[model samples]
Target: MTINAGRHFVTIDESAAGERLDRALAAALPALTRSRVKALIEGRRVALAGGQTIEEPSRKVKTGERFEVDIPEPEPAEPVPQALALDILYEDGDLLVLNKPAGMVVHPAPGNPDSTLVNALLAHCGNSLSGIGGVRRPGIVHRLDKDTSGVMVVAKNDRTHVALSKLFAAHDLTRIYQALVWGAPKADRGRVEAAIGRHPVDRKRMAVRKSSGRNAITDYWIEKRFGPPLHPIASLVGARLGTGRTHQVRVHLAHLGCPVVGDPVYGRKSRNAKAPAALVDFARQALHAAVLEFRHPTTGEEMRFATELPQDFSKLVQSLNSVK
Candidate 1:
């Protein structure tokens, strides 16, 4: 079966103004993945005013600006019989890119084998999967945190799998993320160069340490600021990634004292005496895999994909806006 998606046109309104291009698309088209959105922008399928094309998914969209996109209609994936829904952004013979929602595990483990991305892919792709890193992941080239919803790329064949894996390992593949931080950043765009490693105290967490671990870098920009102690609500921040490491963006952002909103594990206690009542209510970490860009394995074409903020996140932002 052959799947061919279509093109979509979108306009930025007041509600979507200041949002990252990739993020707006993700929310606008829930079926498409973030990675696919970025690919479309990079491949010249996405146009911003005057037929001008954009390659940067993190580019901010102004109010009333119009943009165009091409969305693919994928073929009928072989039936494996799993009812789990998927946000497929782009698909072709050798690769697949998707926007994974928060709280959904990417792969199956001993305890979580039934409702994972792997299970859904198995059902959707059938026998067209390429094994990667052994049995744990069949076609998965990369993964996202269970609580982090964003873009992820997968391989459909062995050749594509090997090539994509090498690109990621060598840091050739570009990945960027957006996070809603509690505090404001000092600079609009600069590098947060730090070394990260497993937490010295916690076995499951990653931390920024003075010694040990690999190099990590994150860049951020302030999209909007709120709350003057006399007004209402809080602030919303945007960020981009320079390196792809385990929790690199999160840890670095937190290290700067601007931990993502609703991050129970790493976030500081709320400033407000009664914090849950605020406009923005984040039950989980407010982080998203906004964009993914790389060279296509089959066609050797450059591709990028992006996803927008989920409904829950969007609601929270609106609530915050209303508090003025």
Candidate 2:
């Protein structure tokens, strides 16, 4: 009944009878998570006493029977593991920090059922991820929108989850984003302090509100200008969040009359005005999470991570250069 790397046999007792197969296995083998047990069973790795393979996770357990589980090696895992590749920036026993690419949903939802960051982490980190609703699920403390790419940190266990959540709640960590906006800010540097909430007419869009919204702040500065300096057409801007809000950067920037380039929902000044075709006809929002800094939850070590702009973003910037 003890769980160690060496023990693989689970002998069911009267208390375990009628319990679900995966549940029983996880209770008996504490080293392996319930989700992992389910995967192993579905992968045809666990067998009953008479060598009969049990593939149903919900199968009821019977007393006085023994089940053997086959744990796969860490590397060269089989088809049971999701095949999505991960750009793991840093990993420890308690956390995983990575650069989540643009267009990938962070969590599984109705429209996005699989092939998400959580699914990939479930495969990549294996049994290391644990604790959600009393089962072993990845702890996603914060998330970026599917279209917004950036640096993110994921907790691997409950302790790390609590710590990271506290850090975000206090706004103790630093987050920086780089964006290509429609025009340069009036001033070199300025701050936007407003309240943000769901749009009254369009449920899909978020807007700055005078009332009935959470306080949002974004400090922005123009990094470079494109086109004639006196009357620039576009600018690359860096924005640091004073408060993390849904669509904070996009909505705040758009409120400033400088919507992010390629933002179809917000950059609606003039439709089909996507001039210079190459520079304007972007497929998704031209924003990226450029920098993230946080202290290690368990180790108290100062950690910082940054990622380069994707090829498309780089090319867009290059195209903007010629129009300068």
Candidate 3:
């Protein structure tokens, strides 16, 4: 990778031959994902050698081919504050515990510039922040993916940030999520241990990799099955993350043949095509971070918090229970 006049350039090598145009380029630019690269290609922000612009992300590239990519300048440095409501469970001088709603991005990003948790924190914390969010990020020690409702802990100072970061890295805390999945597991409870990494061919999604992937584990229990005994339509599951990776609970449950209902990315819709209308009409992934437990960074005392299911989630459960 090389930079010239605010543009990033990558020369394809023998190793990258026959790779998808977006995949090859994204591999060179670690900061960009294939989906983002695809967006750039379609937006005419990517060009090939000899000053030829390309707009096809699927086009395969060969050795000796080179591409130039133009990344637009970022919008701003610090996120502007917003007066968003927060469900604060606990707070003090060094840290805060709150229930983050689904559909709220944890921080500001390209398309989502404001109304994020970080923006809300800026307004709520006022001048008390210690600037631990790093340049482009906020002081979030961990994240519950956007659209994943849950309890999260935010740092107010740098010391707390580092301490929480180390604790999460070591997997010394507890995280349990509740999800409504399409089918019940064969047993009452089980554990899934798999290594996850970017899908090799489809760079936009993650997959369980046979090799060259990071360790991930999820322990789950079948709390209740909502349909017939032999062939249940869906189940309420309690999942404990032994290790947290991106989409860990969703992916692992999908691997267990029980994809979370309303999960667009990893669900098997055809399998449940004839299921009741309750699940068919529901939208968004039926997953929530219900429990978060850890030791307070400064005080060294243990802490635990559990969040209630959103109203929509509760209604969905009621509908599922009424299914034949």
Q: Residue-wise lDDT of candidate 2 within 2-121, one digit each (tens)?
A: 344322778999999999999999998887789989998886567674345566899999998898776644422122336588888888888888988889987765566667887788
lDDT of 3 by residue, 105-135 (tens): 9987777888899899988987676576664
Q: Best lDDT goes to which candidate?
A: 3
> Which of 1 and 3 is ahead in TM-score?
3
Task: Estimate the TM-score of every prediction.
Answer: 0.70, 0.72, 0.79
Candidate 1 vs 2: which has more TM-score: 2
TM-score quality measure for candidate 1: 0.70
Q: Quote the lDDT for 123 in model 1.
A: 81
Across residues 154-272, which tens digit of lDDT does each residue of candidate 1 receive?
A: 99989989999888888887787777777567665667889876565442467886755668877777777655544323456666666677778778888887788878667765676
Q: How many residue pairs clash (N, CA or C atoms closer than 3 angstroms) in each of the candidate models, in the order given?
A: 25, 1, 1
Tell me which of candidates 1 and 2 scores higher on lDDT. 2
Candidate 3 wrongly placed segments (more than 4 Å): 1-77
Which regions of candidate 1 deviate over 4 angstroms? 1-81, 229-234, 273-281
On a 0 to 100 scale, what is the lDDT of residue 266 in model 2? 81
Q: Rate the local accuracy (lDDT) of all candidates.
A: 0.74, 0.80, 0.83
C-alpha lDDT of residue 252 in model 1: 86
Judging by TM-score against the true structure, name the best candidate.
3
